[model samples]
Target: MALFSFYNVRKPRQYNHTPIYWDPRKEALEERIRKNKRELGMEEPLEDYKPQIKGTFVEGTSHLKRSYNRGEDTRARKYKTFKFLLWLVVLGVIFWILFFK
Candidate 1:
């Protein structure tokens, strides 16, 4: 009848506390980088900061040009006269349904 019953167990208290300090602004940037590496004897090289490959990689070089200009051949001759008046009203409704009904 005692398989596991600490049913809400409670026994652990020994804090011996000691931790509360706060002084870092990265120790004033490591004392201004150790006073600029003891007055510049040489530690500066870190500036490529990277980011620059935008646009145009040259495959099919397009700035835009299909080239028919006279105002795109007058709007492609008014869309080929509105597609030849919609194929003359669908061939006059199939020649009035093959010669008038």
Candidate 2:
């Protein structure tokens, strides 16, 4: 009987990578040149307009909206609270009967 299993074990693969050189000063200089050309009317400005994508988290998840809409009406809120409490009492009684009695 084999105390240890070598069939499931394998050597990790070697990774060979060549690092690329980057110059932040050169990149900044290129950006500054583009901005100067745009300011001087030598190059047309690139339209980088982004549309607004804003929405309330409450609106996105409708459970909040449902509760909020119901809350605006006093009668609806009372009825919902009453219904929840009634269910809670009923479940409590059932649990008590099963476990204690």
Candidate 3:
């Protein structure tokens, strides 16, 4: 309402962006040329590419990691449940002593 417009709020400005065009065929052609040069000894081939495995610290250790995480979660959940039950018992005792005893 104009009558309730005590604070003036300005609209956010629009962003004008110009997108760049990518040619996949050109990229593949350049990649092939580089590979060919490396094979022909024109360009020394880069160090043997060993892809890093991000799933585990060591190869075939993902299962161990998963089990460790599962154990930690279960232990924490059990401790939390034990604490909650202990508090509930203490409160129940206090309530019984106050009202019935």
Report the number of the highest-lDDT candidate: 2
Local distance difference test scores for all models: 0.64, 0.79, 0.77
Local accuracy of candidate 1 as per-residue lDDT tens digits, 1-101: 67667776767998887758756897889988977885675654334223232322322344222323223455676797899999999999999999999
What TM-score would candidate 2 get against the native? 0.32
Candidate 3 local lDDT, 18-93, one digit each (tens) = 7698888999999999999999989966763335445346436775566566665557767978999999999999
lDDT, candidate 1, at 8 = 66
Please report how far candidate 3 places residue 49 from its true position, in Å. 24
Clash counts per candidate, in order, are 0, 0, 0
Which candidate number would show the highest TM-score if scored against the true structure?
A: 2
Order of the predicted models by lDDT, top scorer first = 2, 3, 1
Q: Rank all candidate structures by their TM-score, best first, as comma-separated numbers.
A: 2, 3, 1
Model 3 global lDDT (CA atoms, 0 to 1): 0.77
Runs off by more than 4 Å, candidate 2: 1-72
Q: Is candidate 2 or candidate 3 better by lDDT?
A: 2
Which runs in model 3 stand beyond 4 Å of their true positions? Answer: 1-72
